[model samples]
Target: MTEHQALRIRRFSTDSAPVGERFDAWAAHSTYCDMVTTYRSDLPFDAHRDNVSIGPLILAGRTWRHPDPSLAYDAKRTPARIRADQRDFHSFSLQICGTAALRSDASTAVKRAGDLYLLDFARPFERVITPGSEISLSVPRDWLPADTGKLHGASLTRGVGSLFGDYLMSLYNTLPQLTRHDVPHIVRATTELLKASLHPELDTLAAAQTPIRDLLLQRIRRYIDDHLLQPDLTPGSICRDVGLSRAMLYRLFESAGGVMREIRQKRLYRVHQVLSSPDRPEERIRDVAWRHGFTDEKYFYRIFKAEFGHTPRETVEQVRHRRETGTN
Candidate 1:
């Protein structure tokens, strides 16, 4: 098994403060200091918590009940903050459960749950964030292969609707299962999906050419992910859907072992999820496997044990045990 680093998480809270005093301090440590937020005086200030991390890429989830805060980051503050931090990054925010509006040099848009947009931290931007929840990614400029300028201020809801959004959300969902060794691949996939979302026209050329092979591979992986639960999902089906030949598909996934290996990996992971969920303690392991496209029970049992070093039955038992014992 390949050794990977564990995801590092840092959490912050206002400590139940009824005002924005402690919030200012918490926000500083949670993210950056170039911007300021003005909380609404009409609503009672409620406590807020931010779970933040930079595990290869920045992932932050924030929850608050206060009124939409007016946020601003200007030229003077941005320059000084950039000089101080010396880091150039773009923020892609997904409004998980909220109403908000963002304005930047390129565009302005209203956003709600299921909508995602990008903001260049180095530029002058302002946003009015309503009481809600959101998950955001802070990606470094160097990490992205494509130009970030084109993505700045662009709402990615439509561009990312197909595979990009699903891939990103899947990554976020699997954070608990990821290891440090997983960071490199995750980051690379994230970068590629971002590029594809910003410029889908390049996907065709991306595969045939060497300049963006990673992006092409990410595209193929996305397609496989979207069809993972289909019983007829196969290499041929994937090639047809992605407009690639079997030879090209094989060549792309060759480095990661093979196309079948990738599909199996994704399938096994999904099965693990069903078995692990405490709420689904009564779910049958065999049924879970079949739902994820595993047709052979004996083969599924053997591979499940090999892949996770534990039997499917054992995993379900453990989940039930955890639920009964109130443990994780």
Candidate 2:
């Protein structure tokens, strides 16, 4: 496929249209136009949108420049409209330079600049947008973690929300430069980041347990064991190879502190076993530790003592004494 076919891009602007037809033209191009009743302002309407489709995700940058402060537009998605359209996706809008208000059956929120708000297209909602600019991302509902319904119509202004907003902005800025080969990785990373931002808690295994989760966990553990000696082994690599989302992978290992912690402990255990063995008697302790992915001698000693309650040298000495004394 061609580059354009790989990453579809669409641009809509009111600047090229007559002032009288701007609102109609802009609304006609909107993804929500079919499912929403848009109320146009009597004043002149001005808006622009650039949309890029990367895999299953749609990222759009929008800006509205009204000549008067009172010039605003609003849209309402009623139950009838929702039933008619049957759109089931989540839209995360990060306000960059304007303010907006959303009201839904669940809650009401006022989103200011630097705030991010979520909208579920399947739900009944109404939103009023003033003169402002924003980046909006539409993702499949199933891409998000469970229990994200609580985020509907809610605005996130700080913490992980802020970081997610920054990420959305950066992604928007670079969308034009992204290629088809980059789509899958981008989609996975974006989905994982969105899951982490929206749901920061470590979900209990009991809550997320399933046959697939169990199978994935087993596969991940096996992969880690097989690659334990590889110094470059990381969560990212594991996720890519094991076909698991970062959020789900972390949740699977939450009880063990985390995947990285598990990897570290497993590596340390292998090092301990090697150090305690009578074979390869000429191998230096540092070499044994380094072979198992630990490069810093001091850190190796520290963690080795912390894990096994004794220094590496002490363990080696005990093994030597056992060999000399013919002890088991």
Candidate 3:
């Protein structure tokens, strides 16, 4: 194995400082690890036996014994933030000893023993862990596939009573019993289960062109429209952010007729949205289309008819007429 990435670990066993002091203490460690930058201290817990870990592929190492004051952190006024020391790695933290109240990048979630919290390292975020809980975390960036468009910002979990969730719990519960010789196999299994938890549908329909194809196609199409005017908008830029390669990226949209078609479809959808705006009755159809990546009125009209079976002006006229005639 490569050198163990220092998943920064801090244990405040006997510290009796206020929450601000705790914030500074954790912030000091952030400098040592490059993956995280901003640190926000939530919840006022002055004293409690707490241990927090941050790193890639494996962020957890210690278990908190019965050395407690009251264990927990909740960012009331402040939220947790971190920068990825490494670009590709992501994290999945599982509680083995007890349950924890976790608030990660997007939401406030609770994870009990056998349940894992997936944290996006690339984004700035914070997590609040309740005291007296033992955790086993897995970070396996190296295991992720090259084409990850379908996986970017995908929801981070499969709940219990599922195969992946069961595997995660089984792996964590049995890791202590496995010897060093067995680490590789256990780690491999853990990684597989983690991916499965996050991408069950992708696994099933990867070979055949399916709705998984359109889901990603539609999502990417929407993403392009939202950032249509950005100068940096391009296939290369989209691939980088979503973690997909060019070929696999094409495959994801194969069922949707290809990337360009999806983009055109999305642009038409945006055109329709603006033209049907009843609140802006004074706005002309040409100006509305131009405002949303449609610069040429003639070209926009042709494409609008080709895609929606109605000319841009006709659609707007229908909408306006309906509203005026009480037929809408």
Candidate 4:
């Protein structure tokens, strides 16, 4: 692909179109959709942009330096709109250059350079950035392994003097070095770091498993793992078991491709572990698959290969060959 085709960058400015139409277009298509921006009529307006998309994630470093202060509202993400959009993502505004005043239903603060704040598109909120530029990362919410609700309207200014602030800045600076193949792994690590920065006490697995009523994501993850072997592990089952509403459950696992996808992933991971273990020398591949609640041999083979890039029999043969040769 040509450089232009490889990068999906859309630019909007008052010089190209009428001011009202220009701002409206930028708000709709700039980063996340379902947003509306308003500016004062008396002041001059000038907005420029550069955005890069790595797989499902969007990194946009835009110029918020205009004469008039503006408010960007995420009002169109109602339940019906969310269903219509069919996209589960969140944006983190990292103040790369200057500060911006943020106002959400939960809190309000000045998000300065090195500060990172959650931008929830599913809920209604507005932000007023001063004359400066900021880079925002639009990430899949499920990719983040934390109760996103807890992060709504929250800010980690300079990550409380941690390297997380610098880490995010480095991510933005090094976007060109990442390829589509590397996006998923990069996103996962970034999410884990972001979660850790939010809750430092989340350093240990034991501390991570707080009550689900508190909307602790690790506990919900643990619950999912404990019940992954059950044949009836549906979204409804998870919601009922965890005492979370359907919407909340959906939100919790949105970036994970929803709860059903998560269950399949866990099952596939377990199957891979069994296939690779010497402790399972007596177990046949089919028996291991069945033990992991995979009843259809054909479907299991298909998804297993897709998930691991190798067949179950191939994995088992490799394990046996390695064991016999004393090679790991």
lDDT of each: 0.68, 0.77, 0.51, 0.65
What does each candidate score in C-alpha RMSD? 12.5, 11.8, 18.3, 17.5
- Model 2: CA > 4 A from native: 2-6, 33-44, 202-328
Q: Model 1 TM-score? A: 0.55
Clashing pairs in model 2?
none
Best by lDDT: 2
**Per-residue accuracy of model 4 over 102-187 as CA lDDT, tens digit each:** 66675677777667778777765556556677877777877665587568767766433244565456556545434454455555
- 249, model 2: CA deviation in Å? 26
* Model 2 clash number: 0
The TM-score ranking, best first, is 2, 1, 4, 3
Off by over 4 Å in 3: 1-222, 225-232
Q: For all candidates, what are the clash counts? A: 3, 0, 12, 2
Once fitted onto the true fold, the runs of candidate 1 whose alpha carbons sit more than 4 angstroms away are 1-5, 16-20, 33-44, 47-55, 66-77, 160-162, 202-328
Model 4, 257: alpha-carbon shift in Å?
Answer: 44
Residue 219 of candidate 2: its Cα lDDT? 54
**Global lDDT for candidate 3?**
0.51
lDDT of 2 by residue, 77-136 (tens): 777778787888899999887777787885677778888988888887887778889999
TM-score of each: 0.55, 0.57, 0.39, 0.48
lDDT of 1: 0.68
lDDT score of model 4? 0.65
TM-score of 3: 0.39
